[model samples]
Target chain A: MRSKIGLLVVFTIIFIIPTLNYAFAAGDEPGEYLDRRVVIWNLFFRMMVVAFTIGAVVSGTMVWLVWRFRESNPNAKPTKYEETGEW
Target chain B: MSEHGNWAEWVYIGVVCALLVWVGAEAWNVERLVEHVPADAEVIKVTGQQWFWSFEHEDGTKEIGELHVEKGKAYKFEVTSKDVIHSFNIHDYVVLIDAVPGRINIVWFVPDEVGEHEIQCREYCGLLHYNMRAKLYVEEST
Candidate 1:
């Protein structure tokens, strides 16, 4: 379950990053683009890239941690039985 | 003794796959504004002030609070600003254009869905930036 969740996070970031950049960057009038608009769009696109990269890195790290540290038998029955003195 | 007993893992995988597919479909379905705009409609001049928008439609008609257009016709917008840089974004029609000073930005979008749409300033202009907004009313036949 944890692995699946991690994969989901990775996919979501991949899907959202391009659309956000395209929506914010495309469709300016030809030869009339302003420096301010270009600057703002570039900044916003960089921010999105940073955010998605961080999310992907975190999810990937979590997946690796789960693979390395997860219990071998999460639903195992306890075997540390106590002895009765009367018996 | 069972090697594949984690049904929860399968469920999680299914959910994640479904969500990814959904996002992909949504990204694919985003509509473009250029295809909907007409080729031969009148032009409108939009100028953004500090906290208000003033529009000058074709035929020398000046109006505020309401932007009227004839249905089934193409309309072009020449957007600019009076003071600072502002982004003109219409929520429903996928029309987003930057309105800058000393330059005219041309955008063409048709109103196929006749109703009132909200026009907002997407860029952070000034102190009253949050309150800068306007309306676009798509009317039938003039």
Candidate 2:
């Protein structure tokens, strides 16, 4: 849909476009690192950020799903395995 | 494609694709940054022997167990080994490259700090592998 495409474009412009420069940002920063060390450190920091974010997202999702789909939750629907009692 | 609805599937695919693209781009950037040697970089030959590191500067100045370089200058190291495999690592500058027999590996770094840093072999070579080490002195450019 046009609305979906528009939203994607807007999201990319606001978020993705700004970060595109990071790919070429392996240069002198205001610190002890100014060369290859800076590039490697940036990579490590970025990877850790992504790792921690993904870890939190997965853990939070698992906790919410477990609580929402517990057997004690009356609103939880019975899975086909539960109905068949075979799994 | 579990029949997990339409919009959810598309959004999931888009997010995964975006993440992959970003990771790939970052990887390529790092590769370029590490591999692209500067034209003005000073070449230094780093030789890894049984249990010692030797350096040969561009002016043919040789130093054993000690490498003297200037601060704020880019240096390209042509690393190789005389015996078994070894790893040339200068942890202060995050420079790590393999030293394989019959093969030369290239790595470069620009030292911003003018001080003495420890260099060591990260790979096990021989009985004295633990003692295989050197010192890197980054002197201020005169």
Candidate 3:
């Protein structure tokens, strides 16, 4: 479930959002070319979304990892690599 | 780790890397397209003084606190500074470029809307930096 959610985050941030941004840009009616208002505005918004998305995902992952693997976690299980120092 | 799990991890990494590479290429292309100035773009010389912005048109007309441009026409601003480093910004049009001493920086934009906009120096130059502002008039073409 965790990995699935992480993958979903990655896919949305890396793929879906940018594709939507382009779709909106491509739909513009022909009149002005290279309007900085649109270009810079879109770029700023897309980057802001990507940055916040990535930051949230990474922070969530770190929090989850800490909560699941901390020394106080009762459900923590030692894997083969952790037990015998070999994988 | 199990062999299948190891393979899955590797494949996942490979897919992510491929997607990242694709995104990077797309961003590079878009940046180039945005910064590319066409041959017919009108050039306007922009000088960044210590406390004000100045513009010079091709016809030798000059303005200190105001710039008039035609709507729908692409304009290329060749920016430079006289005393210190400054940043030229037309916030309404999102045209921002560094005005460095001894070097000319370039930024271009097409004014789609005909109206009054704001232009300001984004860098700290002197005591009067806060008052360094101008009006951008995008007049309709005759």
Q: For all candidates, what are the clash counts?
A: 0, 0, 0
Of candidate 3 chain B, the 10-residue stretch with the lowest lDDT total is B1-10
Candidate 1 Cα errors over 4 Å, as ranges? A1-87, B1-38
Cα displacement (angstroms), candidate 2, residue B96, comes to: 1.3
lDDT of 2 by residue, A1-87 (tens): 999999999999998877777656655332232488888888989988997998899899999999998989988888777676786
- Per-residue lDDT for A1-87 in model 3, tens only? 999999999999999999778755652332336765776567668767867886798799999999999978999877757777876
- Top candidate on TM-score is 2
> lDDT, candidate 2, residue B80?
97
TM-score of each: 0.51, 0.75, 0.69
lDDT of 3 by residue, B37-114 (tens): 766788899999979999999889999999999998988899999999999999888889989999999888888888
* Model 2 clashing residue pairs (backbone): none
RMSD of each: 13.7, 6.9, 10.0
lDDT for model 1, please: 0.71
Q: Per-residue lDDT of B1-142 in model 2, one digit per residue for the tens?
A: 2246589779888988998888888878677667777778889999999999999999999999999999988888999999899999999899999999999998888998889999999999989999999999999998
lDDT of 1 by residue, B1-142 (tens): 3355788889878976885665554433332323233446579999987978889977799987557776656677899998999988876766778889999997766566578889998999999889888888888875
Report the error of model 1 at residue B132, Å. 0.8
Every candidate's lDDT: 0.71, 0.87, 0.84
- Segments of candidate 3 deviating more than 4 angstroms: A1-32, A71-87, B1-16
User: Model 2: share of native contacts present?
Assistant: 0.36
DockQ-based class of model 2 = incorrect
Local error of candidate 1 at residue A76 (angstroms): 15
| 1 against 2, candidate with superior DockQ | 2
Instruction: DockQ for every model, please.
Output: 0.04, 0.23, 0.18
